[model samples]
Target: MQVNLPTNLLRSFVAIADTGSIVRATDKIFLTQSALSLQMKRLSEIVQVPLFRREQGTLVLTVSGERLLDLARRILELNDQAVESLDSVGLNGPVRIGIVQDFGDEILSGVLARFIQLNPGAELQIRVGHSREIRELFATHLIDIAVYHSVERDEFTVAPARMVWLGDPRLADRETLPLAFMTKPCLARDCAIAALEGAGRPYQLIVETSNISALRVAVEAGLALTCRSSAFTGHRLPAVELESLSLPTYFIAVMTLPSAHAAITGLAALITEAIENIVSPPFDLATDCPIKETEDA
Candidate 1:
């Protein structure tokens, strides 16, 4: 039987195999588990071979799956190269993008790498700082695009991130939690403090720096705990054990001015597409994560 597999399906297959779990794979591919499963099923039907086998609670590739892996990767490489070569024609000039420090360090490198690979001639000026500063850069027209987290629904949201407490385990048992965070104009800091106060839980700000690196250092050294998105914190630090601590959801958003040039707009679309593929899955393109043009607010 002739076999035909879509590029997206192959991408999902490669992601699932690489990540080793549906949850982590979904996060990498930015697809719902159901959606991913559906793609797998369709691929299997086309190939007439089982691709995955459950072994000791792990998803293992079948022999056929293993054989297809190499082919799939090569095909995808060629496909993407052709697409980039075609799409990148005449796409030149610098694209200034501002991003929050925490989120910037996590996804910026990979995002920019892919973008640069596609637009080889394009120049990238990446400015990393606090979310407030990033927003200010956008407002001043210093940046063509801005990626930051917000509590308010004023911008084009890319995804919803769960805010959680993270710190060294040694500091998790404190009666009055020691907080380490960026100074004023930080939504996560404000949200964490509000939650603690609302729960009548005592806490103190032990470290208030202008960046996430210092906050991360403090948290890693058992100096204090801080609130950040799972996207930002990842599993690098343990989540602070606090049954009483309730935090708010943060929106990872893309901000662009209405007067942005076509190149800026195209770059923004690339960013949106890249973010959708990299962020944790179960995203709804219609409501949960709206990737559209919006005026800077």
Candidate 2:
């Protein structure tokens, strides 16, 4: 006999098989116990087989139920794939993204990987630079979205930024701290200087470097203290003293040109979701580093 099963009934059956208890399955499917039972009954009637058999007080999937469970999982997975496929149609075009070097190696790599998997046909053009250069690119419509450190700008909404201080442990007890910094124009460098100045702490600017990697090396060599976002905290260099400074919260805001392409917003949303997933919690969403007591160190 030919049998037809409703989608809800199939879903209920899957839930029951997976959960192994009527009460628990009801919770999983968000249906009343009686309602779930009725659906299960209808499924068995249509299939002309017992999907589950009771063993003592618990329900176990029968041989037929096990076969159906495999089909159910495949069906659900296909349903999800279908939805994602539809969502990706508008996202198939090119999207230009600008990201700072700090997060480029750590957080953005995973996000880009997942985005490509989800939208295989989508074209991505990424540019990496310091925050100011990235911000300028966004303003000029050269890029669709830009992620960077927090800065004082009239344009763009603010998102949270991670900040950290790196220095040599030997300097922990130094009377006066020496600092190595990026160009004065850099956001993190400015914040580090301002924090020290505001705290009335005396610090010597011993070394200045325009390159982030070189500056990191300088800090590791105990040449000077350097500040960076928490995203760059995965250094395996020597034992450097890591201080979590209480700088202004950095925000990764979305920026688009006036009359920008409509697809930019959607792309920004995708990027933002990826960042949130990578940075937030038990994930070590944020790093724990000691704050500079007087900002001078």
| Cα lDDT, all candidates | 0.75, 0.67
Candidate 1 residue lDDT tens string, 205-273: 889998677777888788888888665554576566687777766777898877655556766787777
Q: In candidate 1, which residue pairs clash?
A: none
Structure candidate 2, residue pairs in collision: 159-251, 159-252, 160-250, 160-251, 161-250, 161-251, 244-290, 279-285
- Model 2 residue 221 lDDT? 78
- Residue 128's lDDT within candidate 2 is 68
Best by lDDT: 1
Q: Where is model 2 more than 4 Å wrong at Cα? A: 1-93, 152-158, 235-246, 256-266, 277-297
